[model samples]
Target: MTARYDEIGVGYALGRRTDPRWLEPVVSALGAAASVLDVGSGTGSYEPPARDVVAVEPSAEMIRQRSPEAAPVVRAVAEALPFASGTFDAALAVLTVHHWPDWRAGLTELRRVASRQVVLAYDTALHNDFWFVREYVPEVAALEDSRPSAPEIADFLGASSVRPLPVPWDFTDGVFPAYWRRPEAYLDPAVRRSCSALAQTAPEAVSRGIDRLRADLESGRWQREHAELLELPEWDAGFRLIVA
Candidate 1:
């Protein structure tokens, strides 16, 4: 996974900043835990600031991008966390499980290392409905199809609670679906550089899709079609939180 992230996740930190709104649920999921093990901690985006955290990620490039204020990060993959049993009060893997080559093993390690675990996941529902995939890049649907379902991830982690997390219309983070209300952002190569979906996709496909998207926006077709979405403060873009 680090190999892939290193290749496609270049300049990841520049655009993928933490959105404070996302912290509400992530921090809530931590509950009373004072210490956390952040597995697959890409750029330390959602790691709680108030808690003692030890981050583990596979990509050194991502580790290099972490803010000086971030937790001490270990260069390692989630498949094998270098911690003793019940080492931390909680663990977090946000928007990252899908990248693990051995997801079940990674979840097992997460459970072994912490009493509580939280995972943010994506699934097929939003893969088809998010206007981007439906309108521009249908190949992304194939990628989404290959990813583990939220329920599957929950079952693996022994999570009894799973809930939807909405994407704010003007979310600061540059995660794929976060730009649902701002379609023009996807056309910017620098913006796309931060999105694994666009970054890892075939350049020809991405260029063609962006061109069509540009055309639609120039003709006012995009706004005419998605006028109601403009009025929405938030929309469910298939992001799910699972707590165990």
Candidate 2:
């Protein structure tokens, strides 16, 4: 997690800013927890404003980009958290579980530190089916094959509930599938750089896909084929929130 993020985490805050929409769900899931442990909290994007939150991130590059006003952070990995058991009311891992080298151990640490665990993850099958990935960068599917599946994570966590999380059309956070409707956003270098999926994918494959997408857009082929997406308010790119 540290090494990979350290290389690709440069200017991470530019494209991965917090979307106001996410706060409501995250805060609600946190419930009445007074103190929260945010594991792998990148740039402190979605930390609840009202909670006493402590962020843990391994990458100095990611930590360096955190706002001065953001919660106090510890340079640490999820598998070996430094705190004692039950140190917080809840543990939160947002779009971060797959990054951990040993996710089972990381989750064990989450359970050790907090009474409740809340994780944001995605369904690999659904994510791979996204038009951009299905039609363009098929390499992403292969890349994700090694990552832990949402069900696998849920089973390990003994999740109480798992629900679908749809990506809003104009999502503020520039996650991999944030621009499902606004396809032009993916063409931007900065946008692609912010997403770990594109950053980690084979550069040649990404370039090929981007070139094809550009040509399709110019020739009106993309608009003609995915016209239905333009009218939707949100899309299900296989995102899910798990609570245990």
Candidate 3:
């Protein structure tokens, strides 16, 4: 996974900027935690500004893009954190567990280093149904389904709560599912490159899907089909916040 990020993380910060609204649930879950360990923290985008945060990321390419003023970062993988037991009040893993080669081991390390764990995991049963994946890029769903599900992750963490994190229509994170309401965002090559699912997918598959999507958009077919979505302020893109 580190190698994968090193290859794809070029210009990652360009498309993957922090959306302040996305941090609300994460901070709320952190309660009174003074220190946070952000595992797989790419460019420190989601690390809460108020917390004493330390980031751990394995990819040097991604690390190179981090702001100089961002939280201090350690070069390490989630499976083997360098921190001692109970080093942090809470550990945060946002949309990154599926990238782990041994997610269980990584999550266990989170448990060892922090009293509480907050993970933003997706529920594929709901996520795979999103029109972009269900229609254009079924490969993304196929790839993601092989990873741990929300229930499985919550069970592993003994999560106290699992709540859906809906994607606002104007979401700025540029994650794979963040463009549910804005279909044309998928047409942008930078946007595609930013999302790991799209970046990892076969180019031919993605090209074909994008071509079809472009045609549909140009023909106004997509607008007609998903007209109902335009009225929604937010939609559940199957993002789940697990607090333990």
Instruction: Note the Cα lDDT for every prediction shown.
Output: 0.87, 0.92, 0.91
Two-way lDDT contest, 1 vs 2, winner: 2
Q: Which residue pairs collide, candidate 1?
A: none
Error of 1 at 155 (Å): 2.3
List all candidate RMSDs to the true structure: 1.3, 1.1, 1.2
| lDDT by residue (tens digit), candidate 1, 41-128 | 9889999978999999888778878889899998898888989999999999999998888889989999999999989887656756
Worst 10 residues of 1 by lDDT: 1-10
Per-residue lDDT, model 1, residue 97, is 92
**How do the candidates rank by lDDT, highest first?**
2, 3, 1
Q: What global local distance difference test value does model 3 have?
A: 0.91
What is residue 137's positional error in candidate 2, in angstroms? 0.7
Residue 39 in candidate 1, Cα distance off native in Å? 0.5
Clashing pairs in 2: none
Candidate 2 residue-wise lDDT, 151-227, digit = tens = 88999999999978788999999999999888888899999999999999999999999999999999999999999
TM per candidate = 0.96, 0.98, 0.97
For residues 1-244, write the lDDT of model 3, one tens digit per residue: 4456999989999999888777877889898999999999988888887899999999999899999989999999999999899999999999889889999999999999999999999987787798988889888878888888888999999999998888999988898888888999999999999999889989999999999999999999999999999999999988899999
* Each model's backbone clash number: 0, 0, 0
